[model samples]
Every structure is written in structure tokens, then in C-alpha cells.
Target chain A: MKMKCRQFFEEFGVTRMIAVGFFLAIAIAVPVLHLNTLTLYSQALTRMAMNGVLVLTMVPIMVCGAGMNFALPIGIICGLIGGLISMNMNLQGFTGFFASILFSLPFSLVMGYLYGLLMNRVKGSEMMIATYVGFAVISAMCIVWLFVPIDNLVLRMQMGRGLRKDVVLTDFWAGILDDLCPVTIGGLTIPLGTFLFLFLMCFLVYLYMHSKTGIMMRAAGQNPGLAAANGINVDRMRIWGITLSTVLGAIGILVYAQSYGFMQFYESPKMMSFSAVAAVLLGGASNKRASIFNVIFGVMVFQGILTLSMPVANVLLPESNISDIVRMIISNGIILYALGKGSGKK
Target chain B: MKTIKQFFSENLVVIFFALLCLGAYLIAGQAPYVVVSDLINRVMRNSILVLALIIPIMAGMGLNFGIVVGAMSAQAAIILITHWRMTGMAGIVVALLVCTVISVICGYLLGMLFNKTRGQEMITGMIAGYFGNGIYLLIFLVLFGTVIPFWDEELSIRSGIGIKDTLKMIDGMKGAMDNVWKLQLSQVLIAVFVLYTLYMAYCIVKRGRENRSAVKISVIKWLIWGAALAAVLLIPSVSAVVTRCKIPMITLFFVILVSVLCQFITSTKLGQDFRSVGMDIGIAEASGINVNRIRILATIFSTVIASWGQLAFLQNMGTFSTYTAQQNVGTFSIAALLVGGASIDKATVRQAFIGVVLFQLLFLLAPSAGTKIFNDTQVGEYFRTVISNGVIAVALVLHALNKNRKKAAQADSI
Candidate 1:
């Protein structure tokens, strides 16, 4: 019993340490710097709303025993492409958002399916493969974007490239969701529409995780051969899982692009995995498991940390980009602890 | 016909690389400029950096994605040398020593890590590389110069914490090896060929060495170890010589020696044990091989060599990107290794050299070639970055395809 307890402590201790460090650092930082918590809190919240969705997308693949969704940006890129197309197609307001999402859905499905097929072939080394594949595909698409020929005078720079790395989404769908029922009281503001969208996605994901198919996802993650023996079409489950991840990733990017007011190009979406992965893990999602609550909490806490720490660090260090160091350490340290956690074997 | 087809099949990627280079030249269109010399210079300077990746591959430990440690070790050494304000070849020698010590420690830790997670070495390494980078940052960004000790006050950041971003590595020993003798024969390239020949001869002599009486084994080991130490001491001093410039041949030679030693050690009784442990951990254990110890040793060697290579790389490049350097090295180096015909669990020195050469060649050629053809410099820039990454992806896909096909055929036979 004592040994078992020790083992349990060992496992939980890793998670507990990150949680403690995060809170403790923030706790000490808040008092030490005496900066405005609300400003930082709001920024973190905004980042969470934008990025939380991507972190949530990791569940399906992970549940299916596939690696972390390193290629989450592929789907996000598709969504960005969709927004670009729809905006050019003159889709506006609610119809524009739906149409844009609709435009991206099929692309996401196909891309996800292809990714799933590849994932199946490379059973082991999925994470590294996914990482490289993500990079390669993004870079390839970056080149292809040069010739995408969306002949809108504004969209196309005078030099005749497809679009700038960042395409302003202002006239398109920027702040559409954020402004929907956005409430303000005593310097506290909530982007209600964005939160509503998040809530809906979260609830749906929670429900999906509880469903019969969700159990198969769990099984697929744990033991594919065993799952197959038990009559689950393990490949199909993985395909579906990867598909779900891509779809969620697509929506997540749409939320982000819409909020940020522009689509930053190749490099823009490149950092998705880092920020999303960091947020989820920071919120207490391990590589293999996470909850909807974890998603929300992860995004919130990660954003909260990011938001509050920057100004506070500046106050103390007198350096502008002080948050970068903090963010870097927090994200990487969280990942290391997560990697070091669990069975304690590589 | 079958032999020809088999040769073509085996050398498909190399063929592709050759064709791509040809196509690049053709597309660049009759350029009278001797670009080859510049390219050769690149190959000479950076080739060793890539060559440093060969050992772990030979040991079936995959590409030394843990090269960041080695690179960091190199950085630490160079920093120390510069701090001492050692001018001429002595700086290079000192840097090399610093690199070796740091690499050994780093490699030992990394190797032990890999031993724990046996089968999943690559991703374990990839993460370990990143994690190492974090620690590197913690030390370099927060500790060095201020706490870690340094000779020059200018080396530290303005905040009096951590080392500064870019320090001139070339002032003391920058192109030491490349500048060997300035024999008007591109000494670096010529020497590379010589080393290549020596390496091949070593392999041929390896069979002879094996045939030598078992009585000679310990004698050979002591001789080699002693020679290695003597050279380690002597090389830096020779590099310190100002006759034809401070040639850091010793540092470069040490790397080559380490690679050769690692290869030799692996084929020895201990190496066979390593091979066995890698092939089957349980069987190795049952067979009386101390799997843990073997793993620990192999891990140490791999990580240490990785550190050395990385340091050698930083010594050459002079500037480090702080957080990004190791991660970049791990990704690009691994990709290059895979491109050079290394598989998931197998690699050779020949392949490492070939990979680094071809990969670096492609890296250099892509931008020039891209702009020549596409007229868009960004295309060239993006292609070089993306293609190196793409090569890794393509290699994995091919590896997967090969693996899955073999398994399916076996299943069918069963």
C-alpha cells in the first residue's frame, strides 16, 4: 500500500509541481510587481479563446492512441484558406462565417483522411513524423499560395503574389463573434459570442467523449491490437479520431483568425502547436488524456499567465519582451514534466 | 540487368539528389562563375558538423537528434577560449577540449535517457534535445558569465546575467582546420578525401585487426586510447602554430577519430553486446549481457559525440541562436542523415558524410537555384527551409512504406 501510494504520488506529483509552480510564480509575481491583473487576465482569456480550441482538438487523436496533434495547423491553415476564399467570394456576416467554415470542412476532412492514412502506415514514430510532415506540408502550401490566383486587387499585392503573409480580416469576419453580445461592466468585459462558441464546442466534445465511439477512441489509444480483437475497426476509429481533431482544429483557427482580425501567413500558424500544446498541458492535459474542463482551464490559465506576466515582468526587469522568457520556460518546463511523468519509461 | 536494377533501386535517392543538382545547374544556366569552389568550401566547413551525427546511427540509435548537447558543449568551450582571449591556434585547441568535456557529460546523460526508453529512441531524443535547449537557455540566458565564470567582461549580456548572443569564434580558432597549411590545394577538401581514404582503409584493416590474435586486443585498446589523448593535447598546440596560419586540424581529426573509434568499439565484443541489446533487450539480458550498462555506455557515447559535433558546428558558425540552435540542428541533421540513406534504426559513417554533403549541398544550392529558376528569392528561401524539412518527412514516409510492406508480406507468408 505504501509503495502503491508512493507510485501514485510520483505520478500525480509531476502534475502537482507544474500547478504549484504556475500558481506560485503568478502569486509572487502579482504582489511583487503590483501590475494590473485584469489587463493580463483579459489578454490570457483572449488567447485562450483563440488557442484553447486547438488544444481541445488534440483529444481525438490522442484518444485513438495516435500521438499528439502536431499537425493541428494543417486543418487551421485550411480554415484560413477557406476564410480567404469566402471573403473574396463576398460572403459576409453570419453567412460568411458559416460559408467560410463550410468551405474549409471538406478540405479538413480530406487532409485529415490523408494524414490518417499516413499515420496508419507509420505506426511508431508518429510524433516525429507528424512534426516533420506538418512542417513540410506547411512549407509546400506556402509555395502554392504564391500562385493561388485570387484576383482581387486588394488581396493580391501589386507585385502579384497570392497575398501578404498577413491578410487583414477586418472587412471580413474579425470581431464578429467577439462583438456578439459582448458585455462590459466596471472594466470587466466578456466576449460572449466567442465564449458561447467555445461553450458549445466544449459541451459537444464532452458529450462526444462520453459516447460509444468515444470509448472506442479510448480503446484505440490504449491498445490498437486489443481494440481490433474486440471487434473495433481500429483504423476506422483512428481515421474518425484524426478527422475530428482536424475539424475542431479548423474551427479553432477560424475563431482565432476572426478574433485577431487578420490571417498571418505560413509562420503565423506555425506556432499553433507550441501555444496550443502549452496551454493544454499548462491546464493539466497530459499527452494522452485531457478534458473539456482542462481545455477551458488550460486556455484560461495559460492565457492568464501569458497576459499577466508580461507587464509584470516589464515592471521588474524593465525589458519589453520579458514575457517571452517566462512563456518559453513555462511551456517547455510543462512539456518536460509531462514527458517525465507517468510510467517513467521513455 | 538485375544487378543494374538493384543498384538503381538501392541508390534511388542518391540518383535523385544527383539529378536534382544537375537540374539546378542546368536551370541556373551556363554560369561561368566557379560556384563549385564556394560550394566545396561550404562542404568542407560544415561537413564535419554533419559528420558528427554518424555514430548513434551506427549504433542503431537513430540520428543523433540529441546533437544540441554536443553543440552546447562546443559553445561552452568556445566561450571559455574567447574569455581567456587566447589568440591564434591555442584558442581552437582550448575550444575543442571544452567541447569534448561538455559533450561527454551531455552524451552520458542523453545516452542514459535513451537506454531507459529503448525502442522509442528518436522522439525521446527529439524531446530530450528540446529539453536540453531549455536547460541550455536557463544556464546561458540566466547563469553564464555572471555565475558560470568567464574571462572577458564584454561576453556577458548588459544585465550582467548570461552570455551575449553572438561572440566571434573565428578570431582565435574559427576556420582553423579549413585553413590547414593553405597548400593552394583546398586543403580542407583534399584532406577530406585523405580522411575518407584513411577511413576506408581503416574499415579494410578492421578485418585484419579482427584476425589478429585475441592477445592483441588490450594492447590495441591502450595504444589507441594513448594515441587519442596525445593527439588531443598535441593537436591544439600544433593548431597554435603560426607557420601557415593556426590550422585546427587536431580538432577536426579528433572528431574523425571519435567517429572511427565509436564504429570500432561497436564491432568489438562490447559493440556486439550493444547491437544485441538494441535488437532484443530481453534476449541480451538473458544472454548475460549487462543491458543496462551497455545501454548507459552507448547512450553516453552517442550524446557525447553529438555534443562534440554540435560544438564543432558552433565553433564554425561562431554565433548561436540561443534557444533555437540545438532544435534546428537536431531537425536538420536528422533529416540530412535520413536523406543520406540512414533508416530508422541504422546508419553508417559513409552515409552520415554523404548525407551531410548532399544535404548541405542542396541547402546551399536551393536558394541560388530557386532564384535562378523561379526569379522569386522568397521561393528559394522557403524552399531551402522547407526542403530540408521535407526530406525528413519523405524519408519517414519511405521508411514507413518499406516497413509496412515487409510486415504485410510476412503476414501473408505466415
Candidate 2:
């Protein structure tokens, strides 16, 4: 029994245990301290559904031996472009959201192809290069956002030619998923539509991972040399993984924007990758390995702490804005811990 | 002919930067005097911070993105010094002292962490920097006035719980070193004489014949460099810019001192250990060198020097946004280094200096040039960021390509 306990702690990192404990503490304290635990739970569940696909994007790239897709913003940017254009064409309701997804598909495929080519060239230093590539692309897009000539009154800035920093979608696609069959019990609301969509994605990803192409991807990731010797064409496998990840990333942002009720431009998508990367990591994923279970588990724990910490800290600390600080600490701290764990052995 | 081709290939990035700067200069059409003065001031302001990246690169820890943590240490010190109402040079000294202690501890912890994450040191350091920034923000925004009990009315917000978002350095530490003994040619000559006397005194203490030759060679090199610098200063156009800019003699001297020290350290036993580990860790370990310890030392040295560099930078600027000033330190520094044509696996003091001058020159001119061409100065700002970050990405890609080619060649050889 003692040995089993030790093994449990070893296999599930102490940090993950601490994170679980922290989540449980918040869960218990919310009720014991008479805070509105139901609202917090509802908020966390909504966030988990919203952020699920973004976290899921990391697995395909990781499986193919590409590091975390720090350039996730590129795909996010493609989605933003698609969503904005769809709105500009005056599409509304579910058709508008579907059109946006349709529009983003080509851009996502093209961007993913180029990004995959770039990643292939810089094999050993993919993560580092990906980071700067993300920064470069984001900043370059800032110039585009200003000059791209989108003339929609709702989309453009109030007093300038450039696009507005944020465009509200309340009349269009906002809560398209959330409002569909939302099961409300007293003060708590469950967005069944969003949860179902997220699970569908999770199920599809699981199916793909067990498929022949998926096995080839995993084999290529695990041992590229051996895979190559067995005529696997590792580069093609990795590129496919990247392309799929990018496609999902594009879809992820569309889902996020609908539920978020706004399409944010310029620097909004800049730090989106970090939060997703941290979530997947907190779920027990590493630089070279991850899974769907890790994705779901990580997003819930991460978003739960983010939702609960504000109320909990308000009751405890009261004066300062401790929630934002706690959010920053948790996200950045988890990433640092994840990066450090795979060190020294390689 | 092949040598010429090799030279062109090696310096291709430098040529591109030179041509780009020339184009921007022609487009902006700024007066020579204005451009030169701006360049002089910018170089003096940014050189030390860029120099802070040298040691870690020498030790092969990639770009040292955690230098932002070092900048944060300096900011923490500056905040406290302001709280205590210390003014002038004394304030600067206290801040420097405090920063040194804080940065050494932070650097050691960061170094140990970096040691574990060896091959991916760049990204690891970048993440660690964000993590440190979180803690730094918490301390300043949440704990400083509430838990730590700083009582400066001016530095705190109205709520008395957090430091003000921005603080002015004019009342205390601004240009503290720059204003010290603000020099002329007479001071320069006197400093040169004093340095010569010190060198002579050191020579006498070096009683060994072998030591004498090395000392003599170094002194000769130093004299030649001194002559070249003096000649440059005497140029009429350069002198006009220098005089107009009021370039701080002390700051220039500090830059020179760091350059010399960095060069000297690389010739020492510890430096040898760093180089060996940097080249190949397995071989270094087989040779009985403590690779991890040397890497840590390199990180500590870089972080400490970066803290001092940040102090110099903030003091010169006379004001800073407490939260944002340190955030861009690593990004800007790494971008500048790459712009100078340094690669991920190699860097030098010369590259650091050259990169700073070229990068700052482009930064100084691009906005005006953009306004001239595109009728929008914001384009220039965005362009500079894209160019700098794009340069880093290109350099990384090239390095990766080189590695792949080398591996392929090795396989072919086998």
C-alpha cells in the first residue's frame, strides 16, 4: 500500500497533485465559507468547454515530435480573419458562424502548410523558432489590421480607418452554442450544446489517434529514425500533424469568439497560446507526449482555479486585485515547471 | 576567390542591415546632425544592456531570455530606493547594491533551473522570465504597500496598497552617473595617463618573463584601441554630435570596462570550462569539468551585469513604467544581438556593440522613414518590431538548417 502510494505520487507529478489539491480546496472553501459555489462551477464548466479545442491543438504537434505550437496565434489569426470577413458580408445567426468556419478552412490550410514547412526546416529548435515566428506574425498582422480596409462600421474603429480592437457579436453568433439546450437548474446553467461539441471533437481526436495514420504519426514522433528506416516518411507525418493542429486551432478560435461575444484583433490572440499550453501541461502532458484526457483534465483544473480564485481571494484578502495576479502566477508557473521536468535526462 | 565568397556569405546579414539603414536614412531625409546626435545618445543608452547577453552566449545558454528577471531585480531596487527618498548618486548606489544582492539570488535559482533544461534553454528561460514577472508583479502590486509596508506618498497609488504604475526618476537617480565629473578633453587625457600609470605598476608586479610578454601584448592592443577611439572623438563631425549629445564619459568607460572584463574572463580557467561545456557537454564532463556549475556561473554573471545595465538604462531615461520596462529587455536585446549577425551558438562583444548601433540606428530612423513613405508613423513602429523579430527567426532557422546539413554530412562520411 505504501509503495503504491509512492508510485502514484511519482507517476502523477507532485505539482499535479498540488494543483488537484488546490482545486479541491477551492471547491470545499466555496461551500464551507458560504460563497456561491454553484456560479463558480458553472463559470468553470463554460470556460472548460470554450478552451477545450485550443488545448487539444497541442497533442497532434507533440505526437509528431514538433514541440508545443507556440505559433497557435497564426491559426487564431486566420480564424479572426474568416470571422471578420463573414460578418462583413453581413451573414447572421448560425449561418454566419458556419460561414466563418467555412471561410477559415482555406486560410487555415494554407497557413498550416507554410507553418509546417517552416517547422520542418528548423527541426531541432522548433519551439524557440515557433515562439519568434508567432511574435513576428502577430506584430506583422498588427500592421495589416490597421491597413486591411475592412469597412464594416461595427468592425472598424470609431474614429479611425483601422479595425476596432474588439467587435461585439451579440446580434450575430454570440452564444450560438451556449444558448442551445442550456440546462438551467436554479442558479446553475449547463451549456449542453457547447459541451457536446467539445466532446465530439475529443471523440474524433481519439478516433484519429487510433487510426493507421495516427499510429504512423505516433511512431514517427517516438522514433523518427526508426520510422524513416521502416519507410514512414517522418516529415510527411509531422506536416500532417501540424496541419491538423492548425485546422483545429482555427476552429477553436471561432468557438471561443462566439461564446466570448466578441472578435478581438491586434494583440488579443498574442498570449492565447500560453494559456492553452499551460492548461495541457497542467493536465500531465510533456514536451513530446500528450492525450485528450490530459486536455480535458487540464482545462477544467486551470479554468476552475481561475474562476474560483477571485471570489475566494475577495473574501480572504479583500482589498487587492489578487485574482489576476493568481491567474498569472498559475499559468506561468505551470509552464516553467513543465519545461523543467523533461530536463537533465536528455 | 573562394575566400571572397565565404566573406560575403558570412557578412550577408550585415550588408543587408547596412543597405536597409541607408535606404531609411535617404527616405527620412533627417539632417545629418540630428541623426548623428540621436544615434550617439541611443548607443550610450542601450549598449550595456545588450552587453549583458554576452557571457551566457559564450557559455552556450542561447539568448538568456531570463535577463528580464535581472531587469526586474533592478526595478525592485529602484522602487525601494524611491520609497526611502534617497536622492542623487547615493540613491543610485543603494539601488545598485540592492539589485546586485537580489539578482544574484534570482540568477542562481534561474541558473539551476536552466541547467536542468539544457537543450531548450532559450524557451525555458523565456517561460521562467514570465513566471518571475508574475511574482514581481504580485510583490509590487499586492504586497509592497500592504504586507511590505512602504510609506512613500508619491510612489503609491491613492489606495495606498500598490505602487503607482509609473514613477519619475528626475528627483533622485536620473543621470546620476552621467552628471558625475561630466568630462572634457582634459579629463580624457588625464584618464588615459592614469591608466598608463596603472598598467606600468602592474607590469612591475609581474616578475615572471612569460607574464611580461602577455602583459606587454595586451597593453599594446589597449593603446592601439585607445588611439583609434581618441582619433574618432577628434573627428569634427563626430565631435559635434558627441558634444551636442552630452554623451556621458562615465557610462562610456563602464561599457569599455565590461568589454575588457568579458574578454579577460574568457581567457581564464572558468572561462575555459564554460567554452568546453558550451561546445559539447558530454566531452566536457568526460574531461572532468563541472558543466552544470560553469553554466550556472555564466548565467549568474549575465544576470548580475544585466541588473546593473538596467539601472543605468532607467536612470538615463529619468522615468519608467514599473510593470512594462523590464518586459521588453530580453526581446529587444536578443533581437539586437541577432541583428548584429550573431547566431544562437556564437556571440561576441564586438557583435553586441555592432548590433546595438545598427539596430538603434534603424529604430531611430524607421518611424520617420515610414511616415515619409506611407504617411503613418505607426507603420514604422510595427515595421521595426517585425524586422527585429524576423531577424531572430531567420537566424534560428539558419542555425537549424546548418545543424541538419552537418548531421547529413556526418552520415555521408560514415
Candidate 3:
């Protein structure tokens, strides 16, 4: 029993332990400090839904032994393009949201395929190279966003050449999913539509993982040499895994834009990958393996810290934005620990 | 015929770069003086940072992507020194001293972590850089006023809690080193020729002592290199371009000395151990080398040199965007080195120099070239970024592919 407990602790990690402690402490203090518990929990729930899918996007690629998908920005940019084009066409309500999804499909597919090919060529150094690829894509898009000549006046700047840095979605698909079926128990509102969407994704991923192809991907990830010897197309599986992960990333960002009500471009999506990478890692996933449970749990914990630490820190120290500092430290520190641990085991 | 094929295969990337430069020159239609001057200045400024990359590559750490950490440490030290009202060479020296100490500690920890991680060193280094950046920012932004306590309000943000985004070095130690002793183009060329002749003679003597027949071969190789460099210098158009670009002779000397020191160190026992450990850890371990210790030493050397490079870079610029200046040190330098045709397993001082010149020259011309071709300078900006990043990615991909091919060939042989 003692050994089992030690093993559990070893797997659980001290950073997560401290993170859990902070979460619980904040939960208790929210009520004690006369803060709106309902509002805090509600915000946490929304934030979790907002970030959950992006974190989940890591599972397929990680299962294929590609580590975290640092090239998430590529998928994100595709989604942004799709969403902007849909908005430019002035698609509205649920029609606009789904239209954005449909539009992003081809973009995501092509980008994911090319990115996968590049990743395959640079197998061992995927993470590092993926990072630069993402950077290069975003920067290249920076030029594209300026010169693409979109006709929508709202999307473009007043000078009429470049895209605006931030496009308001207030007139578009803002809160389409979140407001679809919100349940308010006291002030603790549950975004039922968002939760349903997340559940649907989770169910699909779970079903896929149980399929023969998914099993092959997992086997390849676990032991590529054995999989190769057994005649599984490991490279093809990895490419597909990257493709699916990227498609999910596109959908994830569309959801983010709908809820957040702003379509930010250029450099906006640059640092989005790090937080999601950290969140999935926080859920006890490593470079080789992750599960749906890890995704849900990681998003909850990661977003909880970002959500609660603010009000709590504000109450505790009203002089500064201590919560932002705490967020940076905890998130980055967790990632650093994960990266170091991942390396150590290998 | 075999030699021709070998040359083409070996230098495909360099050939491509040369073509790219030619194309850029044609598109740019800028004065040669403008391009040459910019290239010279940039080469002098950025070469040291690229040189800092050589040690880690020699030790087979792939690339020191964590050199950004050293740069951050240097920036932090510079900020502190500036705030303390230190000026001129004194301030620069103090900053360098502080950063060196800080970087050694950071590098030791990084090296130890890398040792644990082993094959994941490159990714680990990249992530470690971001992780270190977070902490560095926290300190500079939050702790400087609260815990650390800085007195200079000018350097601090309006909140008095963080460092300003841009810190001017005009009042402190701007161009202190570069201004020490500048040299004319003719004088610099003559000096370089003299040095090269002496070095070649020494090489001939040393090779003659070791293997009598090697003397003639060494002499021939020296003559070839000398001829190529001389050809560039002797052509009137190229000479006009070179002479128009006044050299920072002092800084050039320092860069050369460091490069020589690096070359010399590789001949030492420690450097040999590093080379062995870098080549194959299993074999190196069996051969009784302390692989981890040597790796750690290599990282320490790299990080310290990178710190010095950052100092030199900022001193020459005379100011810095405090938060952003050190961020791309690893990226640009690594890209430059790769562009110069160095791979993950191999790098040299020659590669660093050639890489800096070619890479920065492309950077210099790209904007105008883009403007001329596409009617938008932003295209040039994005093009350069794409090319820089594309080069690194392509190099990494090629290296991995080459490794796999080698492994397959070995399997076939078996």
C-alpha cells in the first residue's frame, strides 16, 4: 500500500498537487471572502469549455508519439480564415457557426497534411520544428492578412487594405453555443450547449480510439518498431493523427471565437498553444499517452486556476494583478516540470 | 567527374543561397555600398552570437536553443547596471561579469536537466528557454520594484514595478567597444592577409613535423583559400565595395581571437572528450570519458559566451528593447548557422562567419527586393522570416532523413 501510494504520488506530480491545493483553497475562500461563488464557478465552467477542446486536440497526436501539437496555430489560423470568410459572407446565428466549421474543413485538411508531411520528415525533432513551422506560418499569414483584399468592410481596416487586429463578433455568432441552453442553478450557470458540444467531441474521440485504426495508431505510438515489423503503416497513421488533431483544433478555435465574441488575428493566436499544452500536461498526460479524462480534468484544473486566482488575488492583494503573475508562474512552471520529466523518463 | 558531382552534392544549399543573393541583388537594384555596408556592420554585430552556438554543436547537443536564457540573463544584468548609474566601459564590464556568473549557474542547471533528458535535448532546450523567460519576466516586471528594489525611476515602468520596454544606452555604455579602434578597409585587409599568411606558415610547420608529406597538401589548401579570398578583395568592384565599408577592427579582432581560442580548445584533452562524447555516448562511456561532465562544461561555455555576445550586441546598438531584444537570439543565430551549411552534428568558426555574412546580407536585401518585386516591403519582411525559419526546418528534416538513410544502409550491409 505504501509503495502504491508512493507510485501514485510519483505519477501525480508535486506541481499538480500544489495546483490542486491552490484550487481547493480558492474554492473555500471564494465563499469565505464574500465573493460570488456562483459567478466564479460559472466563469470557471465557461472557461473550461472554452479551453477544453484545444487541450483535447493533443490526445490524438500524443497517442501517435508526436508529443504535444505545437503546430496548433496552423489549425487555428485556418479556423480564423474560415470564420472570417464566413463572417464576410454574413452568415448568421447557428448557420454562421456551422458554416465557419465547414469552411475551415478544407483549410485544416490541407494545412494538417502538409504539416504532417513536414513532421514525418523531421520525426525526432518534431516539437522544435513544429514550433518554428507554426511561427513561420503565422508570420506569413501576417502578410497575407494584410494583402488578401477581403471585401467585408467590418473585417478590413478603414484604410481598406489590411485586416483589423480585432474583429467584433457581436453582430455575428457571439455566444451562439453558450447561450443555446444555459442552466442557472442560483448564479452557477451551466453552458449546456458548450458541455454538449464537448461531450460529443469526447464521445467521437473515444469511439475512434477503440477502433482498429485508432488501435493501430496507439500501437505505433507505444512501439513503432514493433508496429512497423507487424506491417502497420506508422507514418500514415501519424499523419492521420496530426490531421484529426488539427481539425479538432480548428473547431476548438471557432468555439473560442463564438464564446469570446472576438476574432483576433495576426499575432493574437501566437501564444495560444502554450496554455493548452500546459493544460493537457497538467491532466497527467505525457509525450506518449493521454486520455479523454486527462483532457477534461486538465482543462478544468488549468482554467480553474486562471479563473479563480484572479478574484482571490484581487481580494487578497488589491494593489496589483498578482493573479496574472501567478498564472504565468504556475502554467509555465508546470510545463517546465512536464518537459523535464518527459525527458528524464526517456 | 566524381569531384564535380561531390562538390555539387556537398554545396547544393550554399549554391542555392548564392543564387538567392544574386536574385535579391537584381531585384533590389540598390547601391552596392548600402548592401555591403549593412552586411559588414551586421556581420560584426551578430557573428559572436553565432560563434556562441559552435560549442554546443561540437558537443553534439544539436543546437543550443536555450541560449535565449543566457541572453535574458545578460539583459537583466544590463538593466541592473544601467539602473546603478554605471557608465562607459565600467558599466559594460560590470554587466558582463554579472551576466557570466548568472549564465553559468543557469547553464549548469540546464545542462544537468539536459543530461537527464538526453535525446530530447533540443525540444527541452526550446521549452526551457520559454520557461526561463517566464521567470525572467516575472523578476524584471514584478520583483524589480517589490522585492529587488530599483532606484532608477527612468528605467522602471510607470507602475514602478517593472522595467521599461525600451532602455536607452546613450547615457550608459553605447558603442564603447566598437568605437575603441576602427580601421580603414585597406589596413584591415592587409592585416588579415598578414595574419592568414603567418597562420598558414605555422600550420605548414606543424604538419611538416607530424607528417612530412602533409606539408605540401597543407600549403596547397592554404593557397586555394588565400586565392579565393584574394580574388574577392582584388576585383576592383568588390574592393570598392569592401573599402567603402569601414570595419570595426577591434571587435573583429575580439571575434577572431575567440574563434581561435575555440579552435585551440578543441585540440585540448577536454575538447577531445567533448568530441568523443558528442559522437557516441555509449562508446564514449566505454572509453572512460565522463560524458555528462563534458556536456555540462560545453553548455557552460556556450551559455557564458552567449551572454557576452548579447552584451556586445546591445553595446553596439547603444539601446535595447528590454523585453524583446533577447527573445530571438537563439532563433536567428541558429538559422544563420544552418544557412551557412552547418548541420546539427557539425559546425565550425568558418561556418559561423560565413553564415552571419550571408544570412544578414539576405536580411539586408530582402526588404528592398520584396518592395521591388511585390511592391510591398512587408512581403520582404515575411519572406525573410519564412526563409530563415524554412532553412532551419529544412536542415532539421534533411538531417533526420540522412540519419534514417544511414541506418537503413547499415541494415542493408548487415
Candidate of highest DockQ: 2
- Go through the candidates in order and give the clash count of each: 13, 0, 0
Can you tell me which runs of candidate 2 are displaced by over 4 Å? B1-6, B183-242
Native contacts retained by candidate 3: 0.58
lDDT of 3 by residue, B319-377 (tens): 88987798789889999998888899999888887788888988999999988977777
The runs of at least 3 residues in candidate 1 whose Cα sits more than 4 Å from the true structure, single-residue gaps closed, are A1-11, A158-160, A320-322, A340-346, B30-33, B144-153, B186-255, B318-323, B404-414
The sequence of per-residue lDDT tens digits that candidate 1 reaches over residues B223-286 is 5655654453457543233122233455556556865875577668877876887676778789
Residue-wise lDDT of candidate 2 within B1-414, one digit each (tens)?
999999889988777898999999999999887897678667877877888888888888888998998999999999888878788878878998999999999999999999878788899889888889889889988887778887677888777778888988646478887777565543565467677768765775775365767767766776786776677578887666545554578778877887787778889998888888888889999999988889889999889988988988888888999988988888888888888888888888888888998999999999999999888878899898899778887887888899888988999999
lDDT of each: 0.70, 0.85, 0.85
Tell me the native contact fraction for each prediction.
0.42, 0.78, 0.58
Q: What is the Cα-based lDDT of residue A99 in candidate 1?
A: 88
> Judged by DockQ relative to the true structure, which candidate is superior, 1 or 2?
2
Q: Poorest 10 consecutive residues of model 2 chain A by lDDT?
A: A337-346
Give the docking tier of candidate 2. medium
Model 3's CAPRI class is medium
Model 2 Cα displacement at A182 (Å)? 1.6
Candidate 3, position B297, lDDT: 92
Model 2 quality (TM-score): 0.92
Candidate 3 on A1-346: residue-level lDDT in tens?
Answer: 9999999998999998898788888878889999988989999999999777888899999999887888899999989988988998999899999999999999999989888887787777788777777887888898888787677788888753688989999889999999999999977899988888988999999999889999999998899999999999999999999999999999999998888889899888987888898888888888888999999998998899889888887776454565766776777778778777877766
